[model samples]
Target: MAVTSAETARPLALVTGASSGIGYELARLFAQDGYDLLIAADQPAIVEAKQSLEGLGVQVTALQLDLSKVEAVDELYAAAAGRPIDALAANAGHGLGHAFLDQDWNDIMHVVNTNITGTIRLLYKVGAEMRTRGRGKILLTGSIAGLMPGSFQAVYNGTKAFVDSFSFALRNELKDTDVSVTVLMPGPVDTEFFERADMLDTSVGQSKDKSDPADVAKTGYEAMKRGDGDVVAGLKNKLQAAMAAVTPQTALAEMHRGMAEPGSGKN
Candidate 1:
């Protein structure tokens, strides 16, 4: 697709995974804050999201592309050829809930590529630009799952761990620059994540106390705007993160098993 010039004078924010859930909320916040948007998701539903965001009186360009491929990340960046992105929310992720060995190799690779490979590629490209310009803010959606070993959701958790670690490293490296990189470690939120990960039968998925996607997004957006290094979304998640810091890995893994192991809810 050809890159288009920004149609408005507002700042531009590039948000991935913006078709729904937290990504959708982040895009809305940006619009509310007066930034025009470039939003992408693997599904065509992103077009509908674009329509809704346009209602907020900001120009929006929606792209439908799977971010699991390197080319797709390149295409997403190319699509913003003429605009200086004031913010980037790399919220795209994939999850597979089951025994790691039981998952398909293809599925595992997609999760890695989407969550780690593609995310880093886009960040490198956009981040380099931001560095040269001496300004920008980045929000990476990590997870509280990253703090533990997700028993049934192993690969998903591992990828988030990489994201969480990478965001902090990047933040430190860019500390002297005006660009800020912040990771948002949110606990379970009411989103399609559980359904798509095939975790609907698990205790965590079935729990009624999941965090609200809007609330999670608001927390991350506020932190990003403030240039904070990282923010864990909820009070419960904050406690979990604090505890995970002192807990042993074996115990954390076992604790995750109770909530995420297959058929955990049934048990």
Candidate 2:
């Protein structure tokens, strides 16, 4: 999409995985705050998101791109068309369930590529430009799950661990510059995450007490605006994060097993 006449006046935010859930909520928040949006997702729902966000009176460009591939990430950056990006919410990621050995190898690789490889590559691309300009904000959607050793959801948690760690490292690297990096670590959230990961039969997946995506988005967005290094979304998650620091790795894995092991919801 061509840059609109308003693009010069309004700051732009690129939000990935924006077709639904936290990504969509983040995009909505940006629109509400007067940011033109370039939002992407791997599915057709992105088209619907653009239509909905346009109601807020901002130029919304939607792309359906699989961020798991290197080429797709490049295409997304090119879509910016050399326009300055004021903020980037690299929130595109998904999970996989079941034992690592039991899960399909392709699915595992896809999860890693989406959650870690693509995320890091996009950050590198946009973050460099932001550093050169000396101003920008970046928010990465990490997970409280990263704090623990996931038994049934090992690969997904491992990827988030990388995100949670990488965000802080990058933030420090840019400390001398105006570019800000913040990681949003949220616990179980009410989204299609469980269903998509085929974890609906797990305890955490079936629980009704998941954090609302809007609230999570707000927590992350506000922290990004403030240039905070990190923000864990909810009180429960905050407590969990605090405890995880002291929790034994074996115990944490056991806890995850109780919540994520297939059919644990039936207990």
What are the clashing pairs of model 1? none
Clashes of each: 0, 0
- How high is each candidate's TM-score? 0.98, 0.98
* 1-267 per-residue lDDT for model 2 (tens digits): 745544368999999999999999999999999999999999899999999999999999999999999999999999888899999999999899999999999999999999999999999999999999999999999999889999999999999999999999999999999999999999999999999999999999999999999999999999999999999999999999999999899999999999999999999
Clashing pairs in 2: none
TM for candidate 2 is: 0.98
The root-mean-square deviation over C-alpha atoms between each candidate and the true structure, in angstroms, is 1.1, 1.0
lDDT assessment of candidate 2: 0.96
What is residue 39's positional error in candidate 1, in angstroms?
A: 0.4
Q: Cα deviation of 93 in candidate 1 (Å)?
A: 0.4
